[model samples]
Each structure stands twice: as structure tokens, then as C-alpha cells.
Target: MANRLECVDVGTEYCPCYLAELNECIVCSQLQGKKFCDCNWKGVCVFQEFVWAGYKAKVTRSTVFTRILKKEEINEEVVILTLKVPNKLARDLNEPGAYVFVRGYFSPSFFDTPMSVMWADEIEGIIKIAIQVTGPKTKFIASAKEGEEVYLRGPYWNGMFGQRYIKGMHNSKALVVLRGIAQAPGVIVILKLIQNKNKVIVLLDKGKVQTNFIKDYIKNSDVTLVEADLLSEEGQEVLKQFIKDKKISVIYSGGSDEQHINILEYMDKYESEAYLAVSNNNKICCGEGICGSCEIEIDGQKMRTCKVQVDIRKMLERKMSRG
Candidate 1:
């Protein structure tokens, strides 16, 4: 059985810098016996709910402003948020497949939502994230106005596809399969790969592709976007043909659990390199691992993405070691 961790443990100490407003802790380390004073009042506990080790910051609190540059309606259910962040934050997000945790206040509750940086321009200090209206947090983000300021914590490095991984994929057939909004992390990675001159084959759902909201942004792009029901037999045949004919070297699959599993099975069959995104339903109170939420298993070892630097290349390493 895989060991798992849940935040707000009954008898464990947590980081002091844990931001209550965001419902996320700042520490990315394992929470076992760990403590820090976020208030820095000589280790005096600021909040009765959590206790931590005492540490002082020059500025006790700082908020990075995410100004909405534009909001485009992809469809009734999906929206794209274009935001301008500080230059320093943009530099941290230079890599493809990076993500940020957003803190937006809604009617009854506040949320810290993890959104993949669909696209980032370091020079322009801009990043784009696409959101599908499935949950309350997303709905709040979609309701944000162009000039509104949204609280954002990080361009978190964990669980990101590394630059070396992208550089290594030269002159090889790359196929990306995406299903629901949950698997949207592949968007920026695919865009970057295509910009690097890789002729990427994107397999997306027919309904999602046909919708003007999502399709308009993707239309007329240099990449080849193929719309199909990837779960169907014909879809499998098409995928197989592309893998065989194009000599696909790497296949990246995201979206629902079913899509991830199907692609992994397919990769195992063909012995192709498989980079699949695994979603954890654990409460991510902190995108930082300190919260102990969002822990996952790798070769029977429990690790948290927020705590460790996860790379697509490591997935292959884990698979090889298991075999």
C-alpha cells in the first residue's frame, strides 16, 4: 500500500508561514515534526489554529499582484485569463508546463487554485491560464475582471516539464493527447514544443475543439490539431498509425484518469516513452509540500509534488526501476 499524507493532521506541527487567506502553507518540506514561526513574534503563536518555529522576514507580508490583462470567453464553460505578473515572477516561469496557485475570494469561501501556465512570456512579464468552469474556485477566477488584481503565490517549479526534456526531443515524432480541463497542463508544453519546430500532433475531443471559445485561440496555429474521440476504436487506430508511421519517440498524455491510463497502456504496448500527468485529489492547502496534501506514489515510495522537483524525465526512471 502507498503511504499518504493529509494536511491538518491531528497532532503534527505545521509551518508558521501558512497563509490562511489562501488555505495554503508556504513550506514544501515534509510536515513530520516540522514547525516554523510565521508571525516571528519571538515564537509566539499568532493564530491558535496552527503552531510553527519562529523566523522573521524583513517584510512580514508581501503580495504579488496578478493584474488581469484580458479575459476571453472560450465557451460558456471555459475561459482564458491573461495576466501580467512582476518581471521576477515571469523569469521563474520561463519553462514550459509550469504552474501557479491562485488565491481568489468567492461568495462564501476563498480558494487557492492550481492553474498551469498555458503560456508565459518572460520578456513581456505575461502568462496565460485557461480555466473550465467546473468548481467554485474556477468560477470565481472566470468572474475576475480585466483590471482586477488576483493574489498569486508562485510560479511553482515542482511538477514541471524541464527544459532538458524538451531539448532532448529533437527530430522525433511527438504526440499529445488531452481530454478534460483537468489535463490542461499540456497546453503550454505543446505550444512550446511546436514553437521549437517540432511538428506536434494534438489529439483533442471533438466537442471541445469545435467550440469557438477554446478553438479560436488554437486555430491557425502552426501545430497540427486533430479532433477525435480518443477513447474510440477508430481513435486508437489513428493513434497507432501515427506512432508507427511517424516513429513517435515521445507521447505526452493528460486530462482525465481514463485518458492517462489509456495512453500509458498504449505506450507500454509500443515501448514508447510515456510522460503522463497524475492527479492527486489530496487537499493542496499548500502548493508547497509542507501541507502534506497532494502526496503521490512512485515505485511504492510516497512523495509530494509540492515538496519535490518533479520532471517528466523522472517518470521514465521510475518505470525502468520498477521493471
Candidate 2:
């Protein structure tokens, strides 16, 4: 009954810019529709990077979870929203902090948004997205409320947290820094880390009001909470000192892309691991792995941000090609 879109209808006239690539396909390039080999083109293949749009989910509850006050703007357009996914799909999402590439919903402007599956209560038939308003297409999403219809695709980009902590199992200490509501979706990843008793410190930068909502949740977790006082330099110093005192294990923060640079600065200062959760939707699309749009040079190789989501260690493994 929802406005669902089963993906990979590309190669059709309307979606000429998209392509597909993955390892398990049974068809050949000629049969599948590849005019040239990747080696001949841009050292990337279209066939092996395929991810399809899956289904549609209509808004069931569209209420202001966090009402905005003064400079606490939500998006550049309609960038952020909180919503729930269907139960059938929610069950498969055992990895809470992972990403689910939502494609079925089309705006007059943009067609896809890879939203983080904040947390899924399978029995309750709900999934939360702390959407940070990004572009014009997402602007429409900001305005949408419960009962409105939208499409979604795969629960891709889910394993980022799992892989991080599994590697951290041998870690001497774990430190986490979460920036805003934008990073709320990654809470699923953090929750799992805490449930497993992973020692990770959390630095949360939230508006005065949003911090209250999270007080209860942080108290219950293994995370060492560091709250940001945005109003005064003295308050902000708390964050600096927390970073100074706590020997950082791993760092994660979500905000504007430039903020990533700041988070990186702190990590670099302390000689710690760091990853940025970019929620402004600046450069993540083509979850297909074929589009090459999500490509960024981390260490030395061009890797897809859409397929990988936020994994700090993977970024460090590569040589810094750009900066």
C-alpha cells in the first residue's frame, strides 16, 4: 500500500546516468549492458557496483521529536526528519547503526537518500532517522509528515560499526565523539558497542534542549559522556579538556563537512583514531557501488562512501591522498 520502488530499473531511458556492479551476477557485460570495460574508462567497473532500490515506506508517525528554537536550524532546506520503517524490513536490520539506502521515494528534485537506520524495534514496526537537512530534494523530506508516502531500497551500509568494534576487541581503550542530532542514527552502532561492554568515550555536541532528551540514554551506556556547552567559551573548553584528559581511543562526530576537519584536528592532536559522520548529505549517492559518485581518496585508493558508510579505521588504512 506504500509507494515502494523495486530498484535497478536503470538502463532504461529515464535513469541513464546509473549502472550496476557486484560479484554475484550471472549475466555477462554484453548481456547486462556494459559498453566499455572499467580499465579502459576510469579504472572502475559499472557492473560490480550494483545496488538496487527496494521498497516504499509511508510515514506512520510524523511529529516534531525535537522542536527547533532560534539558531537551531534543522536543514539548509528540509534536511532532517524522524521516521519509522516497515516491520518486515526492520527485522532484517539487526545492525542498528548501519545504513539503509532509501530509493523508492522520488522528489521533484532528487531521487535517493541513504538514511541511517537509527534504531529498529522489530516488534514495534519502527525505524528512526535523524535526517540532517541536506539538499532541495531532502527539503521536501523535511516537510513530509506521518501518512505521506515515500520509497526505500536496501538496508545497505550497515556493517560499519560491527567491523569497527570487532577490530577494537583488542583495543586498550575506546573513545567516541558524537556531534549532533545528525549522529543520532549512529547511536545504534554505539549502543551495540556499549552492550558488548566496549570502552568508548562519547563527546556529544547538542543544542541545550536536545541534550536533555539524551541524558537518560547516556547514563545507561558504557560511554563516558562529554556534553558541549555551545553558549560560552568556558563551556566549550569542557570539550577541549575532555579531549585533552581522556586518551582518545576512536573518534566519531557528525555535522558539516568542515567540522570533520575540526574533529580530525582533535584526533590528530591526541594521536587517536577518528571518523566523521557526514549527515548534511554533501557527497553520498549511488549506493549502487557502480555510480562512482561516492568516491573519495582516503589513503590512496578511491573508495565509495555510500557502500561503506562511516568507518574510521578503513579511512586510516589508506594513505591520505588529498588531505
TM-score of each: 0.68, 0.59
- Model 1 local distance difference test score: 0.57
* Ten-residue stretch with the least lDDT total in model 1: 3-12
- Candidate 1 lDDT by residue in tens digits, 22-58: 3343232222223643322333233443423333211
Error (Å) of candidate 1 at residue 284 is: 3.5
Flag regions of model 2 displaced more than 4 Å.
1-88, 94-97, 102-109, 158-163, 166-173, 207-221, 229-236, 244-248, 272-282, 298-300, 308-323
Among these predictions, the greatest lDDT belongs to 1
Predictions in order: lDDT? 0.57, 0.46
- TM-score result, candidate 1: 0.68
